[model samples]
Target: MTTALRTDRYELTMLEAALRSGRAGRDCVFEVFGRRLPGGRRYGVLAGTGRVLDAITAFRFGQAELDWLADERVVDDATLAYLADYRFTGQVEGYREGEVYMPGSPLLTVRGTFAEAVLLETVVLSVLNYDSAVATAAARMVSAAEGHPIAEMGSRRTGEHAAVAAARAAYIAGFSATSNLEAGRTWGIPTMGTAAHAFTLLHDSEEEAFRAQVAALGVGTTLLVDTYDVRQGVETAVRVAGPQLGGVRLDSGDLPTLVRETRAQLDALGATGTRITVTSDLDEHAIAALRGTPVDAFGVGTSVVTGAGAPASGFVYKLVARRDGTGADGGAWKPVAKNSVGKRSVGGAKRAERLLRDGVAVAERVVVDDDGDGIPERDAADAARAEGLTARPLTATLMRDGEPDPQWLGPEGVRAARAHCAAAVGELPAAALRLSPGDPALPLVTA
Candidate 1:
């Protein structure tokens, strides 16, 4: 489906005004960034870059979209004609998905004509904000789990389509698997889960239910054991599925205490190898509290998909630079910004690099007033060297002249992103994983 109509009315009005004023073809640069991390998070994860490129590729006003706009009188004939044949012949550079970001980090930069670049603000922000929020929260949960596997099972807790996106984001941020089958089919994330409490309750007896599940799904199926008495339920599960029962899920009670007792019971019943998975509104803090518990894995719902306490990433897209009269006036790309109270934004075509000292990331350096391409000038790197640091470029060209770069597409992209996230998180100082509220781990340096 064309994504042209998934925009606000004012966008078209602004385009019409610009077209009439003869500024539609002016060279422009727009940037996406977050002013501050929500909940004082140490870092934010970049996600949905691939999705943004896909949206841009599909952002066309087909005949149906043009027809609706004409019937609604949303624009003049000239504007409608322009919309009918629109393509984002643009340059886009941004952090790859799963990279870590800090406050004031220029996450995405789009360069094209004002009309082409300006029309994409809403959809771009929409995809990045939601996906990054879920990935960031899920990454923290993974870190807190201390290497225990986690399954994204929050599909029922969010909108149907959003659930799929959330699952994909969570997987990129180190989730072991997801319960959303669509996410598995679309993104190639491992799909898990065989039953819920409803499955056990549906049968007249728990034994009957367990036997039927084991018979169909094999003796190696995870059984929901907390529907009634967890102790009795575990006993029945091991009895029906034998000591080789794969796993059991605890959905209620104090997780630490229940997991401890359940593990002992399972061991006593000669089901020592049977794993114990817990899922009761688990979040990062809750997961951290279960450290050293007998729990084998986690099935998280609600918190991860909802981004824990901070749902949206609070990203803002703003005009950063523009050239006058499409180079006809010979005006250079002048920087622009907003100085509004409590909501100011940085201006200029900027390039970002993270400073590394002895293989550890120390600070983020942002260079302003360089060429439109995201490359640091010699002076920027020289200044960092003077400070005994090495510079690592943060942005890559993900799109060029209306086509995807092909490196950030499909299942291979997801796997690469997941690996990058793991490495990025690992490179942070030991304090990066601290759950306490604090400032960003790496300070920002603007040159």
Candidate 2:
């Protein structure tokens, strides 16, 4: 299926106007960035870069898209013919998936003719906004878990398709597994699930349910132990599966207190090896509070998929620079920007790098009209005579012409991104991991 129609009407109108003005072929530079992190988040994890590349590859206009546009008469025949052959022959470079970003960080830059690039605005932002938001929230939960594994179980709380994407994003942010099977199949994410409370309630008795589950899935399968009395449920589960029971899940009540008592009971009952997983309204805060408990893992739902309260990453795509004309002057690009009252934009193409000091990230630096050179690369103290801080490049070539870089395009790409996310988070300052409100972990410097 082509994604050409997943664009705003105004984009086509603007394309028509540009075509009529005879400037549709002019080269342009469009950038995607967030003015600020939502809720003062210390840093934002870049997710969905691979998805955006995939969407770009599929942004073709076949007969169906052209026929629909023709019937709607959204543009003239000239524009219709243009749409008939539309494809994004552009160069895209930005932060790699799993990289950490901050306010004013240019997450993506698209360079192509105006007509080819303008139509991609909506779909690109849509992917980045939702996926990045979910990934950021999931990263917080992962941080709060303090090494305990977390599983994405929010598939029922969101749209069917979004659930799969959410699971992929969560896995990129350090989540160990997902409950969404599609994510496992599509992105190679680990999938895990146990019997829900309904499974226990469906059987004639809790013992029957446990016996059935054990007999079918083996004693290694996790069993729900909170449908009726949690204590009795645990006891019955241990009795049925014996000390070899894989795990028992707690779904309701005081998690910390219940987890402690349950662990003690399991130990006393000689089921000491049985794990204790918790799963009821688990968010970053709730997960943090349970750090001291004997909980084995967590199954999070609504919060992770819904971005834990901030549903959008608040990204905006804007034309930061473009050639002024098709004549000789066109070869020279001019920076463009919107000076609207409240919503202003920064002009010019940019390059970004992170400044490191003593192996820790300390600042983010952006250079305007840079030729991708002069980035610092040593400890700040040792480079006092130079730029004073080591600069690590953040952006990489994502696409050339219309072809996505093979490195960031499949299940293996998702795994690489997940590793990058872990390394990026590990480089941040200690304060960056605090669950409380604070300023951005690293200051942004525009050079």
Candidate 3:
């Protein structure tokens, strides 16, 4: 499957720029830096490792792409030639897929010669932008649900590949399962679903629909109860299928009231074990609203798969460091940088640090240095700085040589990582997690 970049606004020189500059034995480093949506957003989630891998797999240049490169005349023959044989023989470090990151936190760090690190800017963002947005939304949904499981069934509702990736990212962000059949088949994510309204509409009665589903899919099937009326549906469901039915889904109507009253009905009907699941424009906020409800699981759609408030993380991979000049050994140095309004990216090889100020992470900063003294910040800036703490940055060695990673984690492992992130999220101020109109801006320091 040769999946090219879905869109082609990414410049060819992005890769070639680093390579052409780095070939002179000068090292270049790229940092992905950005913040959550304004209004003091608490934090952002790292998303899109799967899509990043896909882009890396499809990062090769085909004839059409090469023609565009040539037509643009973005680089010289030498740089393009270097690209023809290029593979990411570099090191990548950053927040894991589900990690909670603050502003100035390097969501991802790419280190290699100038060329290799720079070439990957666009495709990486394409993956991270959409996926991270969805993941962040999914995380909020999880938090709102208060431990209620979530299902992902937004594939057909979205585009094809978007659906699969959304389901995968949602699972990593703590969704209990997905409803996309192919997502289940492909990623080993547990799939859950029931008869749609169409199934019930196809039958003569809601009772008939429930009975047919229980017969075909078994008594463990979750019955859709709101097609007509939830109380009456549950009553009919119990009469036909007996007690101990699996669950009943509510698609429309006032959910909190419905769950409360439906709970009474099911319990009265001796179907106490039956659970209530709700789905109807359920975003993180709606999930939060249903916290005390009798709802069991939430099927998240538009809000999760499409990033709810801030759709993309706006993570930008920029060359922050390159050779400033020649070294004492005459090997030359690659000093990097990027200075733009509202988008001043760091330059040259960089390292990031998260320092705990009295057991609370009061500050996060990035250190730019060529030869590290184990103190990760810029030496020149320290002299100019009036006050700040020096700490080892947080970018880790994720990929080396050229590979997917030494240990490929499954959805379960990612789920564990998400748990760890959730714990970290607890340490941050409570305001950042709110999905309401106001989110306090979390401050950061990049030295």
RMSD of each: 1.3, 2.4, 4.5
Q: Candidate 3 residues 1-447, lDDT tens each? A: 433334344455444554455444445567776744532456666767645754665667666755666788866787667656657776677666666676667677766655555567777787787887787778778877878789977775678878887887888778888888887877678888778999999999888888899999877778888887777888888887789898888889888888899999999989889888899888877888887778888897877777776667777777666545434443444555556676665554556655554445555665666652123543533532334533333565566665666333445545555565566555556566687655433466655
lDDT of each: 0.90, 0.89, 0.69
Compute the lDDT of residue 353 as modeled in candidate 3: 58
Top TM-score prediction, candidate number? 1
- The sequence of per-residue lDDT tens digits that candidate 1 reaches over residues 232-265 is 9999999999899999999989999999999999
TM-score of each: 0.97, 0.96, 0.84
- Judged by lDDT against the true structure, how good is candidate 3? 0.69
Q: Which candidate ranks first by lDDT, i.e. highest? A: 1
The stretch of ten residues in a row with the least summed lDDT in candidate 3 is: 372-381
Model 1 lowest lDDT segment of ten: 369-378
How many residue-pair clashes does candidate 2 contain?
1
Candidates 1 and 3: which is better by lDDT? 1
Q: Write one digit per residue (lDDT tens) for candidate 2, span 120-227.
A: 999999999999999999999999999999999999999998999999999999999998899999999999986887888889999999999999999999999989
Model 2 misplaced stretches (Cα beyond 4 Å): 327-329, 370-388
Candidate 3, superposed: residue stretches over 4 Å from native: 2-10, 13-26, 38-40, 62-81, 324-335, 356-362, 370-393, 408-416, 437-442
